[model samples]
Target: MNKKNVTKEKKTRNVIIIKTNRKKRNPTRTYETVSSNHYEMTVAGEAMHVTIERRKGIVNSSLRLSTKGLLVRVPLDLTEKEVQDLFKNYKDWIQSKWQDLLEKKKRQKNNKGMIYYRGKPYQIKVLIEDTIEDKKERIHIDEEAQQLHLQLQSTEKSQWREILKEELRKKGKEAILQRIPELNKGYDYDYNKVTIKDQKTRWGSCSGRKNLNFSWRLILMPPTVMDYVIVHELCHLGEMNHSPMFWYRVSVMMPQYERYRQILREEGTYMARIIDEVELLE
Candidate 1:
């Protein structure tokens, strides 16, 4: 070969060696689940289930207090002693949150005979009238008396639940329709349509087509909280994503949006649970 050919071959060989060395210096990372175990813990004099899950690629350990119980996620490489130490550091937080959870559960269970309308609680009264036509039920609201009267033609008590839910949906739609235009008066956002839904997990949603959807359970929230949700969805018409600009738009309309957001975060689960129980009633 010529001298030029030899020089080119040497340069190519050096480049190949450099690339191979770089690859060896930085190895790829792979994650795997190591082990999972369940234990019991005492929080505020109550025994609770604690689930510990060890997984790879976790740089930090975290403790989460959920409806079911407490969950701990730890690095797979952490030893039992290290995990226990971490848990001890978060013991106070766990206990405090667990106490709050217990209280919330108790309050949710006690809301059985009450119906929340426009943030006010009303006593529910079911009156069955067999003389009326079959499959006909009417809901009467006595605002001054703070009571909801359901007159059902069917004698089966199970049928009243469905009638009550339907009445709530009608009331929710009427309230939302009235509130949306008042909220949009000063804003530039325009919505195509509004829908009230029986959503399982969401309080409200905005579509790309400018349609808005809200949960019927929104009627159970305080007026401020319900207004915040409406404004939040309206702002979505201007900005679809939850970027800083979208939140700024929401804040422009409702300055106290953060306060209502916190209220929803704190009480949303309990309210949703109550709605689910009502839905499940036969």
Candidate 2:
């Protein structure tokens, strides 16, 4: 496989591990158990609190059946072994759910790419009708215009989406550097790195290491939205958390901080989903 494909495979594997870890560490406030022959294992999870669900409604009591291990509701009475046996019987089904959950977690982790002015995913296909190419699936870039494009080389082949995503990150950093000073007249902060990512519910994050990450989807939003994200992360250099004092600092920097926060809450999700989606190859 090409490097891009290899990187994508690694990212996919990591996402799966992240989802499984999340489920294991999930803590909630509700717990209930249901019994069903359809269940494969004594799966314990928390919607609110730890609840054991038992699968039911199978034709054969010994026959294990499953679709995906969704948090289902059933009656209580099935033994833990019965659930385990059921899971063993429908391992593929369980795996499918596991994969779905992993994807969902990935989307959530990146905030669905909802708040971007410009950015790309790991892999993206774009048309540059003006350019000529020897091969359909060749890597193409126009340095002067700062444009990168991709095409599907083979109908049956899968390509890494990370290249486009990485490009998006690079562009996003440029955007931050260019806009920070303009947005905050005297904005001065030392940041280790400026990067863009797919976030589920946050516009930006600041790590103790002085690295800043923003949702690339923010590029798709209005300029005001993008400015808000830039200022927010920069402000983190001074305050690491969202304390009242932090908000006051942010307000001093941007008088309309509340307006941007409201816009993000109300419209950010739709924007994030744009980059989170994968278009099928023809």
Candidate 3:
């Protein structure tokens, strides 16, 4: 290749796009589906649409609920009537779970000051310190109490929101730094920098320079889901694209990765909305 072509190839190889962050929020059950079998079901007196999908590797039928609608994934051999029968068998259980989801949405809508850490929500309490003699600021995280107390001096003028944001960044960076090494063990994954950014749309990204970059928002997810993102970017160090070979390597490192992947696909947008006050999404 000529010098210009060589540089272009080099750029193409190294300039990988950031990992996709699905931030589309769908509070209602309206969604576009190609499946002609789409139909509506009433659970908890709320109408939601349902769609059935068949895949080759699926051995048993599975069901999940999301804002878009209910999805039933079944093995290729499973007929539509069989799926209906499965739902019939689990009717009561499905209604209970769907009711719980609606209740959670009610809480989220009314929540004023809350933060999510490691897949759990903690209430954020900003208060003027009543106990400090010198009037210093401190953050007391009561995990057991499920609260973050931001005690600021009477004269302190910093935005408590910024303070809390910085605190989250520190915690996120610490967690990512700590977990990467633990997950990287037993593997020959090679990479350069591990940057934690306030990425609005991506859980993680890997560059052609072999640098690994992750969003601090990932700290909001469950640890297993966070680890999946880590292993995903690390896998790119060996294979640069989302080819089958790359997934095989990721599977070798984290066998249950797909379970977390599904969680991300379903709840990622909701998670992104959690502490969205300071960093508003467009």
Candidate 4:
């Protein structure tokens, strides 16, 4: 999730990668165009010289033909005419997708960052207290309220933050380990290491040797959901490819896996976004 968040004043550009597959009836297929600026347009390999703009929310989205394909950027809340005009302007370069681009937009719209942890919306707040849970312990989180109360047990604030991070890592790792035995019940997995990282790309990854790495954000998700992710990765030790056989193995271990996978895909975006955009400093 090494996603760069564009600033308010920054002028962002939308770049799409047009893939031309000679096998198809329409050999050229417009993949997708993404932007921090909200707008929708497709890019074609044939059209690489024109630009168009659409209104998305408060910003105007305009698309132009680029070396990559089509680039669009526009102002906020543009009309249908503006969007169609851009497509018309670059019709040749804007090939249609097999699945409508609108469907992808729908997926994005349905995805939310609002995490339902411990049966409620997580509201993270930070406060300072002198109470000592541990000598160097600096952060105590309320799962219900999603609040992080910082009790600076060390003279150095940086030390306190580091200690807090360590605590989170330790807790998250333990949580994952505790479920390993149950998840791998009849099966045997040489569960090696469980480390917490601010990973940018994936939620969790497992090595051939059964070593597991998970994002600290997994701690923010529901216990069952988090366990599902851990189980899914651990299963990778036995089967690497995401084939039906591999999924069957995962299902045998975690019956509610399908549900969890759906939740993770829909909600993981917001979780990654939180880790990227918000720093809970105590």
Candidate 5:
């Protein structure tokens, strides 16, 4: 028997650090401190928050941007002047990214938008009505009208959004459960378990234990695309990695798998954005 030795690869940390000697500048510049560990600076007329995080493994300084604010990771050995200078050098890049994030947030605030289900666009309709049921129920999908109706007693947008996600997850779970068995028939592989998850970046993952994890957002994709993802993960049951044999197994089940893969590569980010915006409504 030939035994295969597989070594797990460590993922590289995404840390950006500037470690170059800086030219001497005006020493009289004043900086506004937000807290003991945070510094506030005005760049291009926009307020940028700088946070300093000290850690053991990090050898250099790094800058990261998010919706909340900017984070700077620096080694404990560096002086405050060095850190401030580093921030000044990357001020332009920081300002650009901050502006971009603000624009994205503005766009995401408009949650009254269309969502795709099974390759069809449906308008989201929030219906507020008093009902006997304490829990939010009576979710309806009008296929003929191409609208997803969320019947909720609470007029709060956040509450309605959560209810809608729960309803969608339920629907997604049902669809995955119904489809997996049909696809597994006649196949030699015996899957141990199947689970639906509210994943952000991944569509599906297969464990060595024969357990399959699928994203609930699969319901938002076209039927063909969803089938491709299912088959792709199922193929992993036979071959754990994306070898040529794995592709062969996937192609046997889905001949046009490449087409669907291309579609996902192009539009997957947009779909993720839609899901995130809906769930993150304030």
Candidate 6:
């Protein structure tokens, strides 16, 4: 075995130990499509689009299963036989991931507008109020009743989405800031600035400059899930990659990290779709 493959092999083994993680997969898929950087292939009765990226260094071939497709990264130095063996060994894992993603897609579709919050089947009503109490100048959420009320003075039909998004951004920032100190208890990781952003794919990220960025979508997840993402990124202040040490830091800070991690892996994609289907009322 090449020294390059050994490096990735070690990482892969550790991933197995962590055992609960990211992305959606499609196993029994066969799409006959071609792109300059990708091609279609079938593995274990499942068809997929695969893209290969070769890199220099102690190059170990690895597979990444995403909602888009599979990516195969390999060492530039590998022989034809080595490359072949890599896929032969990885095929089962790919199929398993594909099935999981397919199921997630189904669940995502079923959830459309089923739960009310600024989206269609438009179940929540707008409660118009006059000279309201100390509620938000614009909107108030009645969580138990799942309603959005508009201060009669605050109705700018074009801005409903913006108003709601800004409120979450403000509240999301305060919520994250409050959790950070308690979660940061002993880690004492030096960090600057916590920002809530509107992001498409990621739940949270830690910057190279030591700032933290969280997706506003996190506001929609369970409170515990939000905390898991916070610790996941905050730990990055000390360890950046998802290496063994990175996961260890996370586990130490939040012992239930694995459970939360699994929850996000299974349901994160669905949550995003719910937010995407919003049809603001006119």
Ranking by TM-score: 1, 3, 6, 5, 4, 2
How well is each residue in 1-282 modelled by candidate 5, as lDDT tens digits?
Answer: 001111221211223445433322436543332333777777656676767776433344567776677787665555777677766766677777778766756655554566667666677777777663755455677999888777776655557666767777887888888888888773667898898999856999999999999988888888887888888888899999999999999988888898998777655555655855654222
Query: What residue pairs clash in candidate 1, if any at all?
Result: none
Tell me, by TM-score, which candidate is best: 1
Task: Write the residue-wise lDDT of candidate 3 on 1-282 in tens digits.
Answer: 012211111111112111112232444534342333678988898987888776554333456666556777655555566667667755776687677677767767766677677887778776776565543436577888888777765665356666666767777888999988888884767778888998766889999998889888777789888999999998888899999999999999888888898787656656766676632212
Q: After superposition, how far is residue 278 of candidate 1 from its true place, in Å?
A: 4.1
TM per candidate comes to 0.76, 0.43, 0.61, 0.53, 0.57, 0.58
Q: Provide the lDDT at 191 for model 6.
A: 93
- Window of ten residues with lowest summed lDDT in model 1: 13-22
Residue 54 displacement in candidate 1 (angstroms)? 1.7
Q: Tens digits of per-residue lDDT for model 1 on 1-282? A: 112211221111001100111111224555556788998978888888989888675444556676578777766655687667655645676777788888877767777766666666666777777775554446677889887777766665677677777777777778888888999985867789888898746989999889999987777778888889899898889888899999999888888899998877787545544544642312
Clashes of each: 0, 47, 1, 24, 2, 7
Model 1, TM vs. native: 0.76
Please identify model 6 stretches exceeding 4 Å from their true place.
1-103, 110-123, 130-154, 280-282
Q: Tell me, by lDDT, which candidate is best.
A: 1
RMSD of each: 13.3, 15.7, 13.7, 12.7, 11.4, 9.2
In model 5, how large is the Cα lDDT of residue 246? Answer: 90
- How does model 3 score by TM-score? 0.61
Summarize candidate 4's per-residue lDDT along 68-92 as a digit string, tens digits. Answer: 4354555434345645564564454
The collision pairs in model 5 are 16-62, 17-61
TM-score: model 2 vs. ground truth: 0.43
Model 3: CA > 4 A from native? 1-43, 47-104, 130-137, 155-158, 278-282
